[model samples]
Target: MTEQHGSDTGPRYAARRRRGGIVSFVVGLVATLAFFAFFPGMPHVIDWGAVLASLAVGALARAGCRAWMAKEAEKEGKRIGHF
Candidate 1:
């Protein structure tokens, strides 16, 4: 008797989820920035320095997430295949 093996979905699912999340994050970020740019003096206030800081933080966050996922893939014995 042969044992039935399940199809692999981990890589595909993870990639899809990551792509969707990044796209949504980027879109939301752009929208928020545009809103602030257009209505700079609308209310409480808007600080350009804060905007730059947020962008820097986002960059660092993205890098960290990528590094973590890469390590996970390595542990799973998956090759870091080229896009």
Candidate 2:
């Protein structure tokens, strides 16, 4: 059996892996806003600071998850295909 190394992965692959956080951040922001928008008085009822904080938390979680997954894949000698 053969094992693949991280050196074989290109910058594009690294970028692809990192993109998860950015996507999650955008999705989180949109989702948060959407949730607030459902209310009749969104602007007055929603706390903007909390919404921003939630987006930040979501992005950080995504980054952590991506890193863990990459480490596990590397340990298993598995290739993470392009998204």
Candidate 3:
């Protein structure tokens, strides 16, 4: 069933945005760090390219997740006659 809410941007919206930002940035940073960790022979210098790619990928993933969730919610809303 669709969730019952007074508005789309409810009290949790800010929290969710903050969390998502932190998560995405952390995931990006960790991904690059992990790659460097695996290659001991390589220079310790961080790969800015990989780090950027990680952030881009994380953003894409978040967008994909949001799209899927939105579709599901739309379906549920329609089913429940809420929209």
Tell me the tens digit of each residue's lDDT in model 2 across 18-63.
7766777677767766677675755645576858766776777677
The 10-residue segment of model 1 with minimum total lDDT is 1-10
Work out the TM-score per prediction: 0.51, 0.53, 0.49
Using TM-score as the measure, the top candidate is 2
Candidate order by TM-score, decreasing, is 2, 1, 3
Worst 10 residues of 2 by lDDT: 2-11
Model 1, 1-83: lDDT tens digits are: 53322232356745754774476556555655666667656553448864775565555555566666666666766555432
lDDT of 3 by residue, 1-83 (tens): 54645353434544554566567656765776677657778777667776676677777656655555456646655222211
> Runs in model 1 with CA error above 4 Å?
1-44
Alpha-carbon runs more than 4 Å astray in model 2 = 1-8, 39-44, 75-83
Model 2 TM-score, 2 decimals: 0.53
User: What TM-score, to 2 decimals, does candidate 1 have?
Assistant: 0.51
| Backbone clashes, each candidate | 0, 0, 0
